[model samples]
Target: MKTPKFLLPVGLACATVLSLLSAFNMPSWANFKDAPKEIIDEVWQVVNREYVDPTFNNQNWQETRRKYLAKDYKSREDAYKSTREMLKGLGDPYTRFMDPKQYESMKVETSGDYQGVGIQLGLDEKTHELTVVSPIEDTPAFTAGVKPKDVLLSIDGRSTKGMDIDQAVNFIRGQAGTSVALKFRREGKPLTLSLVRTRIELKPVKYSLRTEGDRRVGYIRLSQFNAYAAKDMGNAVAKLTREQADGFILDLRSNPGGLLYASADIARLWLSEGTIVSTVDRDGQRESITVSRPAMTSKPLVVLVDGASASASEILGGALQDHHRAVLVGTRTYGKGLVQSVHSLSDGSGVAVTIAHYQTPSGRDINKKGIDPDIKVELTKEMAKNLKADQVATLADPQYARAVDVLGQQIAGMPVEQVVAAAGKPFPAERQPVAAENQTPVATP
Candidate 1:
């Protein structure tokens, strides 16, 4: 059978429609109204053939199709509802059916620019509460003091109990200059914030240089792994290198991740030749993505991660850690190693289905088991508040401070064992230093 023409590249965590039909080319309402059964059958067939989990999460796929198809879907809305119910039976959060509106929103989000209160939201599996994944820096939500892991209680006075991610996003998004009231709970305390929506153009990469005596440490914070991330990061590294930066700190805190290719491209900046990541399909077929580009920098490196770091963030961090190129510091990262590909349907809707599971360069699976920091640093309530208020200096943030310290020691030619001992963290058996000869030479741009 010929594959669908709308198949696109894989995205991590969030749903991002890759290939889409133009609005003008979408099927008319009358067509949808007459072909509800056909639409429902298409959805079922796609999931049955392409879902990553062959067992269907132990749910009978044919039974689900039969149960949903038994009812007569007289309208497009009815077919949409039935399709969603069918997907929900798969028990995978990343695999979901998107209606036309939701599919449009996904496209806008993947484009790296949009109008909304800038924030990425996720649903908490345990509590079933809508949680703030991360606030886009300098946007309305970020400026309004929205922090990661904040549980959303309500939106504009309507409770978010049992609300899905798309529904919550719709409630929070509005026209530029409009306002949305958000009630949320942070650290077990209730709080409210009002934010004005705006045209959010994400500058995914931000950098600043910190001085420690005669040495300058280049600090780069990657907010997400969007399409422009690699280019922006390259510019930052080049500028910092020209400024005589001797060490580097990569902050991946609260980064929920984006495109897989973007993450691999960023990894190539530090690694000259090595496995960046590997993906395993349902049939045990494994494909490795290796770094093809030359190294941008050979400076001593430290990576900062937190509970909110996931997907592509984990991929980059894990590759660096496995290659012994950088030491990870901070709390355990959010583990999300599943790969999803979004397919555009004939009716302008879409379905993001999990296609495979990815592994780090060292062959470690980080799905439910998150990557542990080489040196763990937990944030205190006071420090969290200070960070939100922009009152804390870079050195005052525990994780970041630790990363800088480690990077400084590495620049001074400290041994890995000594660095671990100094940080008061146990040295793992796998923690070995990469020999100088094994380190790839930095390539000139």
Candidate 2:
């Protein structure tokens, strides 16, 4: 999920009012041959006066409105499509108007599953390179040897360069049994791979119990907050408790986040009965999302984050940090405070529009300003090379080490103050951006 944009509060309120007034009050024909003339007049007046660019197309609003209304296109939906075209005339990609159907599709995107290729991708804003974060297990990508850290070059024959993240995703996914070829690079070696598409059932949450030295740690890596995230997390916690796990390390690094409800649901597993997050709409109507006491997870916890952590990730991290439920350690999170609504269209297309802003439990706005770690620890390239070069026991990632250290503080009965004091200083390093490819495989599904 991407960070939402926040327009001026006053501007949003005014726009909401205008949208409601324009969309409501339709032509009610009791037994007439056509829609009443009042409807056309209403649309014409609103379009002529409220449209940002009234000098648009150099065409008369009343004439255009009449042309549309005379064809039995006088419903609220018709007016909305017409208004959308007006906004599209502005040539702004971010500025969009989503109808009810498109909005519902977006909601389904957040909460439902569909058949498609299975790879999680991340785009470098500066380089415009798309990196493969991870492949969904048992899916085509995973089956075809796609791995994390591989840079995606193209999909089918289309280059991903200049393509938006969502646009790229749409190209990669399709109906089951359909094939897409991808060109990618790994460690400077160019390669082409083709795989048959299939339904991807992403288990966003993964957990394991391990014995590190003398301590027992429960590790859970959350990639995204899918609908069943909370259930998976609860099961992990229960398993750990049964196994007498001494501490917990919740890894959320590079997690782009998902389902706002899923994030709150996961947080409820740790937080007591209270507000989890607050959403304030354009009208200042505040909706407080709270957790029940029965859902709280009572264990020593440490949550990990990095630049890729955003949206729902920030929500969970912020909630845990505010309640002191977990000690966050790693780079600052990806700041994204906006909430979006995805509306579907009649023609099967959809639009995602920013609607509101969200705040952490402590009332902090993390949009564009990510959450700072309580104990900041930067992962250096040297550490990455060391782990890749060494035959260390289970993966010795630097961020993981820091998380274990934080969790150890409580498990070893050490004072939180001492643990905080033991945190190492930051070490900044430059890492090369991942590369992209051009040609796709000849054989694709």
For lDDT, the strongest prediction is: 1
Segments of candidate 1 deviating more than 4 angstroms: 1-34, 391-393, 415-418, 421-445
lDDT of 1 by residue, 225-310 (tens): 87689999999999999999998999999999888878888899998877777777787777776765679998888899989999
Candidate 2 structure quality by residue, lDDT tens digits, 1-445: 1212222211111111113233333354333323334333443433344343344446665456546555545565675555555444434333345444443333444443666677767555346588875666557886787866688888897987755445567677777888889999988998899888776666777888988778899888887766677788889888888898888889887677766766777887777655666666555555666765575357788888887787788888888776656778888987767665432333333344455577776677787798988788786666645664232224477777767767877787754444655665332111111111221211111
Clashing pairs in 1: none
Off-target runs (Cα >4 Å) in candidate 2 are: 1-113, 121-153, 161-166, 175-178, 184-196, 346-348, 385-395, 414-418, 421-445
Model 1 worst lDDT window (10 residues): 1-10
Residue 267 accuracy (lDDT) in model 1: 90
